[model samples]
Target: MKTNPGQLSQLLKKSLAPVYLISGDEPLLVQECCDQVRKAAKEAGFHDRLTFHADHQLDWNAVADEFSAMSLFAEKRRIEIHLPTGKLGDGRAVLERVLQEPPEDIILLLISTRLDAAETRRKWYKELQGKGVHVPVWPVDADKFQGWLQQRASSRGLSLTRGALAIMSERLEGNLLAASQELDRLALLANGNTIDEETVEQAVQDSSRFSGFELVTELISGRAPHACKMISVLQQEGENPLGLLAVLSRDLNLLLELKSAGGQAENPASFLKKRGVFQPQRARAMEQAARRLNRAQLHEAVALCSQIDRATKGFDPLSPWHYLRDMSALLATRA
Candidate 1:
């Protein structure tokens, strides 16, 4: 059956599946799930483990051979297969065939960043649900994220105020990897005391100011100068251009969603919290932006962002700063 990231530990404690198919777009949750599986396997005395990458072309026979061969060193073995790009073809056939006459002392863990579609899930995923575990790692919402942050702080024997949590959540923007890193930094910086809002603000700087939520806010507010300055700062700090484009694309999509939802205010924070927008500042910024930027302008901004994204990813060696400057100028213009 489909399981969430939070319930993974309890599941592992109760049952050990012969095969685990872990899939999701959220890298942090996906990785955490994989870690849990590995840790559980190790604890259960499956010390000998093998890892394979799906992206690297290998003979299917080799994988079959590896599964067939018994480990000389350990009584049980765990094999981890990472499909980073999710190019694993008709794994159902191989898996079904193997599962029919399963190996006695081997467990297989298939980790992927992309989940099968609903149809695929109905077909292969459903079959595996009963026999093996199918864990879907979804992005944590903002409200849940606050609890996670508090738990993380408390685990380190530290405390955080509500305002500090809000600021940290805002700075991290529901990116759990970034949030976790920032929290770790804060834990170290605080050194066994409650972390205050000022300390959190001082700890985490807006690294990519002209991207993601910040970019959306600046463009919406008609603050071209601030956007330009942010772009320069990001460039000087060696931020990747294509990376910036991806962030812009995501932000534009969110703006479109807000625009489509209309002036009802519908709690963008709550909506985005489910999609992993944990920070209060970001939620407020988007709320303000929704009021200011019209649908047409938002659409145009999205188009510009997509074009810039493609250009940056292409072989054209032009300066990314120039493209960013031009985009800023275009965004500055009144609709």
Candidate 2:
């Protein structure tokens, strides 16, 4: 059945499903759910758990043979199939047949980076849901991030100050892996004491080169030299061009929203606060960009960003870094 994330623990307590289809873009949540399932299976005496990485070349017959094999001890068996790309390939036929008549005494877990497509969902996914459990672990948004942080801190016997939590949340940008790593680091440094904002600020450097607010500060303040330098540094640091494009797109889209709102507030933070831009740094950046750039210029910058993104995906001749540099120069120019 389709299960919500909140209900997963309760579901796990009652009975383990014959098959679990856990799919989402959130790496931490997905892994956590899988870990939970594995732990529960282990507790139920499922010691012979096997793992398979599904790929385009996966052998369906071999997989079937393994699943259908009788356990030496006749105990419960667990099988985890991790499909990172979520493409089942030619194995769909075998999988469908198995799903029609699932093997007894074996718990099958299917993990994917994201949910199957609508068609796949209707076919294999629907069948699994009817016979077993389908859980979708979505990414944690900003509102839910605080609870996650607090729980993480509490688990480590570390108390995090409100200010520190806010800063940590901002720095991690809702990425649980980064947030978890930072929490671990903070726990180590604090030695079970309370972590304050100053500690976080001192420990964490602003490593994000493609941060929209930072880029806006560079462009609006007429720091073309700095903007160019930052772009080069980011590329050298192996930052993904597509990721940078996403940041730019998000910022430009917010700017467009603010422009449409038709406000000339002296403190743009208040205006942005009303518009759901809660991060203080992001609000400040938006304010700066709003003051310096006109609507037309913002639209042009967004278009250029989209073009660079498309070109990076092999639609043009220029390399992603070169395209980014050119776009940065164009953005630096006053329209």
Candidate 3:
């Protein structure tokens, strides 16, 4: 049974599905849906809850064994299987058994990142969807984001003026986690007063909206001061270091490829255009940014990014965000 995020609450009110598959790229929404299912299961006599992190190469046996094993503590158990990659891998066989012969008195809640169409076409995936409640959460559209902000504020006992809600939507940059946290902050600070633009302005001055695209644009254009400022704002806004690194790494790889291949073409910008640099403004920005650094400096910047990646993965002692700030400064420097 397919379900939209909005219909999840209503679905939970009915008899719970044996398997609940919640998929979304947004971490907050995915977790929220899982929470709803777990809450319903708890109320329906699922007294014990177990959690498993099934990253790409997870041990399927452990999870399968848990599902098949008899419960010791509680008569009914709820098992949460979190698969970040959304790929069943070797675990597909185990999932087949669980779906074909679900545990007699257990609820299986599966949380995964977004799945591509090709992945979704797999027989196992299709079976899971057919057998369970499949909830796919799409991102909120830009025009409707302000409405979401207003709704979120209302839930927190906030009476936000349109102007204030718009301000919050802009500052939050469509990050639900950030928006939720900011709302928590405002609820305490507002002290029963309505939230106005003036209040939001004062509250989010140091922690303004920080988009990865904008941050990379600033650094690529050699605006070191602006890039550094944005980093501070991003940190204050509770941006994830891993996500920031992903954007920077992608842009750096493109720069590296362009630098290596630019010599073959008469016009570097035109060459970049063939590779999806469609917008004139963005093409010009990349071209200008290319002139600011030599191949060696660009290579070094990529190396720094790799180090930041390692730092983020717990292979280094340095903070990933701190290294990312330093890397931005390095990239912004003229060769």
Candidate 4:
């Protein structure tokens, strides 16, 4: 009942699962898996598709009725429930009821964000996995990102030379979405030719614009100007403010973790390696930021993040972008 993307593709060719729980933090991988399931279901005659956004106010009764009702034209249906927060809430009870007498003509597809360890232990989650498939996509880390890029290029009928691969992996960093788009662009530009460093240098524009991860790097290196530039580009690209906040928040918390552990006294590379900061550049940046900012400054930066959130939701008079700029200055400025 548990499968990866490769196995899932092969499995789809043989048979479609009656239910699928596709959850992940990586949007590209999650979307791809869902697309595979959708394609398979359509081929298997699940022509009628209905989508519902699961939230606190979701009408579980309506979903229950739809599950029990036969299609007027006798068409197989796929019901997709998207839970962004990954909490079923009251929907768990309704799903349990429906799964007890699993409907043959209806396929249930639950797409969610990352599920923590606790969520997987719930009875409803286990029951769904017992009856169907659970595909949990994990983010490709820095060590594996180049290999992932190479594989993606091969799939697109383009082969990347070693130097080309190095340029792309460094330019794109760990952002999968950017890497994917760059590969698509390369596929067109190569025109059946192998992508060498010269070809890549000519064809691939820097794809790091889509990376929210870079904002953290910029801030830590005491480059407010660069960080501010990233914020402007991200805003122009319609990047989600909350998503950006999540990125900054995560790194700040990690900095706090290091500070708590006497990071200044310890060697950074070894300290970060123990905590899974595999990328040397990132670990160095984190260490610099930790040593540069005192505890009070770090705490104030975190508080400013909260104000940004409040401002975003209209709880504060200031604009979220305004708060973001202030936080950028706070972290990037030398104390």
Better of 1 and 4 by TM-score: 4
Better of 3 and 4 by TM-score: 4
Better of 1 and 2 by TM-score: 1
Q: What is the lDDT of residue 260 in candidate 4?
A: 82
Each prediction's TM-score versus the true structure = 0.64, 0.61, 0.69, 0.73
Clash number for every model? Answer: 3, 0, 0, 0
Better candidate number, 1 or 2, judged by lDDT: 2
Show model 1 residue runs off by greater than 4 Å.
85-87, 118-124, 142-144, 208-335
Q: Which structure is stronger by TM-score: 2 or 4? A: 4
Using TM-score, give the best candidate's number: 4
Q: What does candidate 4's lDDT look like per residue over 222-264, in tens digits?
A: 7888888887877786655654565565567668778888835
Question: For model 2, how does the per-residue alpha-carbon lDDT over 1-335 read when each residue is reduced to its tens digit?
Answer: 98876788899999887788887656567777888888888898876888776754557788888777888879888888866444576667767777888877788988875554643655666678788888887756667778888888898898988999888777766456656767778877997678999999988545543253465456544467887888777777765555445445556656766776665554566666765578676677676666667888876676566456546657558777787676667666664
Please identify which of the two predictions, 1 or 3, would achieve the higher TM-score against the true structure: 3
Ranking the candidates on TM-score from highest down gives 4, 3, 1, 2
Report the C-alpha lDDT of model 1 over 179-250, residue by residue, as the tens digit: 666777887898777888888778886663325456545654557899888778767776656544544545
Return whichever of 3 and 4 wins on lDDT: 4
What does the lDDT come to for candidate 3?
0.74
Which pairs in model 3 have colliding backbones?
none
TM-score of 2: 0.61
Model 4 segments beyond 4 Å from truth?
Answer: 207-211, 216-229, 237-275, 278-335
Model 3, residue 22: distance off in Å is 1.2
